[model samples]
Target: MLYFLPEPPEYAPPPRAVRVPAKLSVRVFPEVIAMSHPYELAPTRPLSFERERGITEVRFQGGLAHVEVRLPGRDVEAERLVLLQAVAEAGLPVLLIKLHPGSVSFALPDAAIAERAERLLLGRGYIYAMERDLALISICAGAMRDLSGVMAGLYDTMDKAGIRVAQTGDSHDALFALISGTNAEHSARLLRQTFGLPEGGTSC
Candidate 1:
């Protein structure tokens, strides 16, 4: 059995950075399982499993943008209010969001929404930072939750391919990874292969 050691939140390691490689290692697992099982119950060498493929799309949401809202005095309630207000101003939904010390980062559909969000929040005495040219890549495989290793292997494939993931979200039926427009085509191609999908699956 594998054992793990815990680390303090302050000292927790940052997420791994993936790089582009000429080829991905087909061997996802580095070590073999050492188990005392009956021969009849043992698994096959090259295991074959089933997976559901989601309708994957790499949408360019009208010039991607991210706005960072500073949390005044660590007042979490105030932060929530600011976010809700921004959403109302955008007239569109947020693509993704992340929180950091004294601030929260949001991925919006376009520069227009980001600009509007910033102006609205600024009027309320909030400080923020903004960025653009981002995108949303969602893998909508309904079989994601039902199967183990589907998501893991997906990430592994991406990591091996050197795809840069900015923000991400997932549900039982889907997975999402945020990236820049420059990486969209490559990311789409790799994801297509990762899911074992035909060309038709990569459309819209």
Candidate 2:
């Protein structure tokens, strides 16, 4: 978690020079002033459409698979640890890990790793499900941590566009969602338009 203190209503004036006693025979100087407060010094101007929307870019990554492992017993923590260790031992790199009441889910970079992970789980008698041909769409912003309604707006746009999101994640600067690989390009285009981003703003 992070906390942002409000900027002071007014900038503090620079310090004045102070006099030293003759007995000390020392000259005292105020510390050099640092940069001014951004809130006070920044220029005031109308924000561009994209800047106002806060979204800076849209990114896509294709050829990923989503997997979920079900922990059926009472010790879900132990089960989760063992499952993760098994994946690590198999040398499968996972992303966007999420925990549910009885299951843990993550994304694999490619189908080969997904298949290998599934085989490992099956051999270890762990129940799981895997979905292939998924693409990750990232909505990047300058201040996502402070933005409101961005996620809701994103989901609403996707719902209207008939894009079904399989998994989601977020960070201080971006939001991520996994959708069908077939919809990757279209989803990126739609999001760019919806957020008022310039054409060709997406990168893979």
Model 2 C-alpha lDDT per residue in residues 43-102, reported as the tens digit of each score: 334545544347789888899999888897789898889889988988899999999989
Cα-based TM-score, every candidate = 0.60, 0.71
The stretch of ten residues in a row with the least summed lDDT in candidate 1 is: 53-62
- Per-residue lDDT of 170-198 in model 1, one digit per residue for the tens? 77766777777777767766777776666
- Candidate 1 residue 120 Cα shift, in angstroms, is 2.2
Candidate 2: segments with Cα more than 4 A from true spot: 1-53, 202-204
Residue runs of model 1 more than 4 Å from their true location after superposition: 1-62, 89-92, 99-101, 202-204
